[model samples]
Target: MNGNVPASTRTLRVLTFLATQPGPVPMERIASAVGLPRSSTYHLLKAMISEGFVVHLPEEKRYGLGVAAFEIGSAYLRHDPLERLARPLLAQLVAEIGQTAHLGVLHGRELVYLLKEQPPRPVTLVTDVGVRLPATLTASGRALLAELPPAQVRALFPTPESFVRRTEQGPQTLTQLRRILADEKRQGYAVEDSHITPGVASVASAAVDHAGHPVAAISVTFRTDAIPSSERFLLARRTRQAADALTRRLRG
Candidate 1:
C-alpha cells in the first residue's frame, strides 16, 4: 500500500483483486480493494482493458478479468505441475490402448498440445507437444470446447475465417461446429477422424475442474483401421476414465 510501490506491482494487485471477486466490480470498489488512488486506478484499468487483461462492462460500470487473463492462467497450468501429473496417466493410457496419447488445452481458437505419450508401436502423429490445431477439427479441441459456455464459444469463433481447416474433413462454419459440440455434450466424449492427419482417429474427454469447467483434454490417437468399429465405445470409455482421473487430481 506504500506510495513507493511500482506501477507494475499495483497493476498486478488490481488484477489479483478482480480474480478473487465472484463477478464484475465497480471501479470504486476495485480502487479501495487494491489501495490505489481512484484516479490512478481508473488509468490502470483503462490500460489493462486496452491490453485485454481486463474487461469493462459499460452498462454495469464494472470491471472483470478478460480473456487474456484467462489465457495467462491457462498458460501457467500448461507448465510443470500439469505436465508432470499427466505424464504417468498418459503413459498408462498408452500401455492399455497401445496407441499414442496427448494432453491439450484450448488457446484462443486452437488446441495446443502440452504432452504426448507413445506406445512401442506408435502411429505417426502430428500432435507432438507444442503443436497447435484448429479446435473444431480435433477431438481434444472439441472436448474442451464442448465444456465452454455457448456465448464464450461463439466469441472464440465469431466468423468464417475463424474456422481453420487442416484437412477437407471437419466443420467449416459456426453451425457445423455447434452441431458437433452438441453431439460431444450428449455423448460425454469427442471423436475426430482424419481431420488433423489422414487415417488417424482420436477419442477425447475433457478434464474439468470442481466447477465443471474444462481445464484440458485427454486424447488417444491411433490408426483408424487399427480400431474396430465395435470397440470404439471401449476406447471412449477409457479416455473418459483418464480425463476423470486428471480432473480428480486437479480438484485435490
Candidate 2:
C-alpha cells in the first residue's frame, strides 16, 4: 500500500524488480525495494506462489520467477515466429481440404486455439481462435497430449474429476484417456467424432520441437457427413504432413 498505488501495480513492480536481479532475492529486500509492508509482501507472494508466477526457496528464504513466468516470457518471444510459420500452412490446408483448420497450443490442461482458417464455402463450427476446450476431448488436444510424457499426463489429470463432458462423449477417467492417447500416439495422429460438437469430427497432428516435445497442434474439422470414418485417416495423414512441416521449421 504505497498511498493507493494498486496491489496489481505493486505486484508488477515486484516482478519488474525481480527480473532486474541476477537471481532469486530474499523477502526483506523485495519488500523494502518495492515499498510494501513485509506482511503485505508475504501475502502477495503467497498468492503468486499458488499461481506459479513465483517460487519460494524455503531454506534460502528467497523468491524467484517460476515456470509459468518463464512460459509467459517465452510465449511473448515465440508468438510472432510460431504464428508466422503456421498461418500460411493453415490457409493452405483449408484450401486443399475444403474444411476448417486450426493451430492450437496447450494452456495448463486445456487447448487454446491460436489460429483458424476456413475454406471458401466453410461450414460454421464452434471452435475458433482463442476458444479453449478440454484437452482429453478434442482431436488436436489429444494430439498434443499424446506427445507429452506419461508422467506429465498423469500429473495433468490426476483423477476422474479432471475429465470434463461435452456432448456426452470423450473419456470420463484417466485410465480411459490414456488408452485413447496411446492409440493416437502409435498412429501418429488423432481423431475425434462429435466429442466437442455434435455432427462434427476432426483429425489432428502435433508439431514437435527440436527436443521432440509437442509445441503445437494442427487440426482440420469437417462435418461427419462430408467425411466417412473409414476414410478419415486420409485427412489424418494430410494433417500430419502439415504438422511435420511446421516441426521442421521450428527445429531449424
Candidate 3:
C-alpha cells in the first residue's frame, strides 16, 4: 500500500498480527490490519497456508496459525527462554510459601520440569529439572492440559493406555479425565493429592500466551499431613498469582 516494503517484511507482519489475535479471522481483516491490498493479501495468505504457517478454514472462510508456526514456538522452547523467565518467580514462591516449587511445560502427552526450587526445610519431591511425568497424573501437567481445547485433549489421551499411572490416583478414562480437567478449569487451579508421591500434594496454575494457550505451569508441592484443606486454598491462590505474573512476562 505504502512505499514498497519487502515481501519478507510483509509476511512477517502478517504472521505477527495473527499471533496476537484470539482466534481465526476473515482474510479481509488481516489485509486491512496489515495495510495490504486485498489481492496481495490473498496471495500472501495462500502462500503461507501452503507452507503450514497459516491454516485456512474453508467452511468459515478464515485463517489462523498452523502447525509450522507452532513448530517454531516449540523451537523457541528448546532455547529455554521460559526457564529463564520463570526461575526467579519459582524461587520467590519457595521463599514465600516455604514449599518446593517447580516450573513445567507440556511435552506431547507428558510434562517436563524445567526448574525446581526447594526451601530450607528439606522437602523431597520426585520431580526435578529434566524429569518427565504423565500429564494426567500431575498437577503441573493438569493445569496446562485444562487450558487446552477439548478436541486436543481427546487427541492426546484417546485410550486407557495413554493414562500412565504413578499412583492409584488420577483419572483412568477419557471421560474421567475430561471431568477432572473441567473441574480444574472451573476452580482456577489444578491439584494433586498423593498423585505422584504418597503423602505429598501439589497445586498448580498455568501461564498463558497472547493467544490464551498455556505456555507453562507453576506448581508448589508440600506434605499433605502438614497442611490442612483450608491452607491449600491459600497456596493455590499463590501459585495462580505467580502464574499470572509469568503470563504477563510472556505477553510482554
Off by over 4 Å in 1: 1-48, 54-65
- Per-residue lDDT for 88-118 in model 2, tens only? 9998888888889999988767888899998
Q: Write candidate 3's Cα lDDT for 20-43 as tens digits.
A: 876778999999999999999999
lDDT of 3 at 22: 69
Error of 1 at 19 (Å): 6.4
Give the range of the ten consecutive residues with the poorest summed lDDT in model 1: 149-158
lDDT of 1 by residue, 1-252 (tens): 888999999999998887766567899999999898899899999999898888777777888777687688778889899988888899999989888999999888889999999988777777898998888999999999898765456656768898986788888888999999999979989999999888889999999876566789999998889999899999999999999999999999
True-structure lDDT of candidate 3? 0.87
> Which lDDT values do the candidates have, in the order given?
0.87, 0.84, 0.87
- Tell me which residue pairs clash in candidate 2: none
What lDDT would candidate 2 get against the real structure?
0.84
Tell me which residue pairs clash in candidate 1. none
After superposition, the stretches of candidate 2 with alpha carbons farther than 4 Å from their true spots are 1-78
